[model samples]
Target: MKIGLFFGSFNPIHVGHLIIANHLVEHSDLDKVWFVVTPHNPFKKKSTLLDNYQRLEMVYRATKDYDKLSASDIEFNLPQPNYTINTLVHLEEKFPDYEFSLIMGEDNLKSFHKWKNNELIIENHEIFTYPRLSEGQVETQFDGHTKIHHVKAPIIELSSTFIRKSIKAGKNVKPMLPEHVWEYLSEMNFYK
Candidate 1:
C-alpha cells in the first residue's frame, strides 16, 4: 500500500486539513493518507499546542468516518523534538511492505533543503506537495524533481492559529473545524 504521511501538530484537526488529505488520496496514486499527529514540532512552540492526546482525539474524530483517512500516533512514542528522517526510518522497519510518501505544503517544500538528511529522504520517498499561500520560493534544485510531485489540491488558507485565536476571543469558528472536532473543543473549553 502506498500511504501518504500528512504530519501536523493538529492542535485541533480542522476541515481544511481534511480537505487536503481527502483531495490527495482521491486525486493522487496514494491508497490512504494518514494524519501523523506530532507530539511536538521542532519549528513550533510547544507551549501553544494543546495536549498531544487531546489533539490526537480530535484527529481521530475528524477522520473516523473516512475510510481512506486515519490518525497516527507513531511520533508520540518516538524521541521528543523528532525529525522526519528518524520517523521514516522507524516506519520502514515496522511496515516493510507499505510504501510511505510525504504530504507537505509548498511552504514546507521551500525549506526542505534544511531538513535533516534531506537528500536521503528525497532519494527514498516520493513527496506529494500541495499549494499553500506562504511567502518565499522553493529551492531551484527541487523544481521539476522526479521524486517530488506537485499535487493540484485546493489551496486552503485556513490555519489552526487563526481558529485558536478566534475561539479564545469567543468568536464562532465552528465552521473552520470538523463537526466532531468542534464539539470536542467546545466541550473541553480548549483555547478559551
Candidate 2:
C-alpha cells in the first residue's frame, strides 16, 4: 500500500486538514493518508498545545468516518520532540511491505533545511506538498528527493490556531470543525 503520512499537532482537527487529506487520496497516487498526530513538534510552542492524548482522540474522532483517512498516534510512544526521521524509520520497520511517503505543506518546505536529518528523509521517501495560502512559492529543490512534486490540494485558509482562539473567545466554530469534533470540544471545553 502507498501511504502518505500527514503529520501535525492536530490541536483540534479542523476542516482544512480534512479537505487536504481528502484531496490527496482522491487526486494523488496515494492509496491512503494517515494523520500522524505528533505529540510535540520541536519547532512549535508546547505551552499552546493541548495534551497529546486529547489531540490524538480529536484526530481519531474527526477521521473515524473516512475510510481512506485514519489517525495514527505513532509518535506518542517515540522519543520526545518527535523528529520526522525517527518516526519514518520506526514506521518503515513496522510496515515493511508498505511504501511510505511524507505529506506536508509548502510552508513547511521553506524550513526543511533546519529539520533533523532532513537529507535522510528526502533520500528515503517521496514527498507530496500541498500549497499553503500566503506562504508563497517554495523552492522544492533538494538533493536525492527528485520524486517530490506539488499537488493541487484545497488551499483553505483555516488553521488550528484560529479555531483554538475562536473557541477560547467563546465564538462558534461549528463550520470549521467536524460535527463530532465540535461536540467533543464543546463538551470537554478544550482550549478555554
Once superposed on the true structure, which residue ranges of model 1 sit more than 4 Å away at CA?
41-45, 136-139
Error of 2 at 82 (Å): 2.4
List the lowest-lDDT window of 10 residues for candidate 2: 138-147
Each candidate: what lDDT? 0.91, 0.88
The per-residue C-alpha lDDT of model 1 at residue 83 equals 90
Clashing pairs in 1: none
lDDT of 1 by residue, 7-119 (tens): 99888789999999999999999999999998865567667698889999999999999999999999999987799999999999999999999999977876889999999
Candidate No. with top TM-score? 1
Instruction: Give one digit per residue, the lDDT tens place, for model 2 in 114-188.
Output: 999988888788999999888877664462357786898889899899998898898999999998899999889
Q: How close is every model to the real structure, measured as TM-score?
A: 0.95, 0.93
